[model samples]
Target chain A: DAGVTQSPTHLIKTRGQQVTLRCSPKSGHDTVSWYQQALGQGPQFIFQYYEEEERQRGNFPDRFSGHQFPNYSSELNVNALLLGDSALYLCASSLGKIVGGELFFGEGSRLTVL
Target chain B: AQKVTQAQTEISVVEKEDVTLDCVYETRDTTYYLFWYKQPPSGELVFLIRRNSFDEQNEISGRYSWNFQKSTSSFNFTITASQVVDSAVYFCALSMKTSYDKVIFGPGTSLSVIP
Candidate 1:
């Protein structure tokens, strides 16, 4: 009965470098969503994947992309990282298509872009 | 456009005191959902409760209670007999059925319970 899990829990990268954060959704969950939470701010929606396809996206720029595997695991990739990109990247999962269900979140991967 | 707002940036209360966190939301869809989450120093968001647009009944769970008002477009959370363990950042979120299940979060209200 493991909940959402993400890794690497912490990482550091410099400008013009890229970083990949991974997440395993809760057992029996099919959808995965990514969020970015800057210090002193709430989690901001990044994008959501369902059926291995991006179902929806937020206001984030193209530097941020993601993938959802057949196993319902997800990866968030950020390229050309900037200092502003340094934040807590979170992965959340829900059972059904609608968000009316509870969204379980992972501990989050903290990305520190220098 | 959809948005969630927690006007209270921070609140501090002593143990055993009661405190309420305010949340105001905006959405164009007729039917939507609202949620509350708590984030401790550990940084993981713990889900608290969810309320759909149609159901306005205030929910009570142990010492926690939520008030959902459609006319006001506000969903408020109240913690009774609070303890030191209750110290955390609380967030309010909104999800519209037509918006592809994307959850929009508020700025969050940081609650500090002093012993």
Candidate 2:
């Protein structure tokens, strides 16, 4: 089974523009989490969604928001993107809540904001 | 506040040599969880191992091992007979028992295995 799939492997956007990245979680997984990784740095947790509601969130601002559909597919939408948003956006899926189960990551969508 | 720290920015070792990645954590919660993840060149984050606050016993899985010490709030990972494929950026993270909490990650340690 494909562990996790993300669309638009790479994206280029100008400042103030918006971008949407997609992710399809592993089959049978009900929870999905999003992260941002800067060059040579570890990923920073953005937020997590379960059952269409955001169960937990990180320190990220509202510019970074996400949604999990009824089918479990997820989307990360960033509005008024800034240069700082140029990084790898990762989507992860797990069997249960991240607190108890292991999270599997995807290849990540590389975003470069000009 | 909760934090995970991997002090070593980069480490290099020859093939078949042993290496250890250090992870130090800080949290006020009585019960928490720690995890190690590997991100290779492919950019996919892979879960390496995990240790809960209640369990201090070190674990041995094949050629990899982890040492969890509660007294010092440290969880270290060691690789034996390392191979080229072992090269990757290692990250340490902590998860609190808070109702709405997310895992926090360290800067990461880059491991390079040369043949």
Candidate 3:
């Protein structure tokens, strides 16, 4: 049983550039959620997707968006990225209708915006 | 607005010394969930435990234990006989059982266990 997997373990981009980070949820899981963890801080909720539909979102701006495919994999897209956007992007997966299930997290994709 | 607060910013203790991490939460919903996660230097959030609003039973798993108090809206975690490898940043999170699926995380407490 494979755990959650994320792509581009490390990446660098310039401000105002658009970036896309991908994630594959754990097996037997149907929900994928995205979180952002800045240095020295805990992970913050971004949004969640279930059944290929966005179920909920956090306090992030319109520049941050995500998509979930039928296979339960997810993609986090950030537009007009700011320097503050440079952080670790973590993807978590759970196996239930509610978000209270045990969340299995990926190693996270570290984005460094210049 | 839901919020989780970890009062201790950082802690250092010698190996074999016991340590406790405090977590206080704020939520209007009676039905909610509390969680603790450990983030080691390797940079991954590892789930520790989860406690629902109704369950006040303190849990003990190996050298780890959690105390959930709905009356005070607090859930504390304790590690017994800590080891050097136990050093990590601990986070507390809360999520309501309602339509809101977002889990609010705290500022995390960094624990350093020295040998």
Best by TM-score: 1
Q: Quote each prediction's TM-score.
A: 0.98, 0.97, 0.97
Question: What stretches of model 2 exceed 4 Å from their correct place?
Answer: B99-101
Candidate 1 fraction of reference contacts recovered: 0.74
Arranged by DockQ with the best first, the candidates are 1, 3, 2
Clashing pairs in 1: none
lDDT of 3 by residue, A1-114 (tens): 999999989999999999999999999999999999998888988999999998889889999999999899999999999999999999999975655777889999999999
Question: Which parts of model 3 are misplaced by more than 4 Å?
Answer: none
Give the 10-residue window scoring lowest on summed lDDT in candidate 3 chain A. Answer: A95-104
Best-fitting candidate, measured by lDDT?
Answer: 1
Query: lDDT per prediction?
Result: 0.94, 0.90, 0.92
**Can you tell me which runs of candidate 1 are displaced by over 4 Å?**
none
Local accuracy of candidate 3 as per-residue lDDT tens digits, B29-102: 98888999989877878999988888899999999999998888899999999999999999998988884478
Better of 1 and 3 by lDDT: 1
Ranking by TM-score: 1, 3, 2
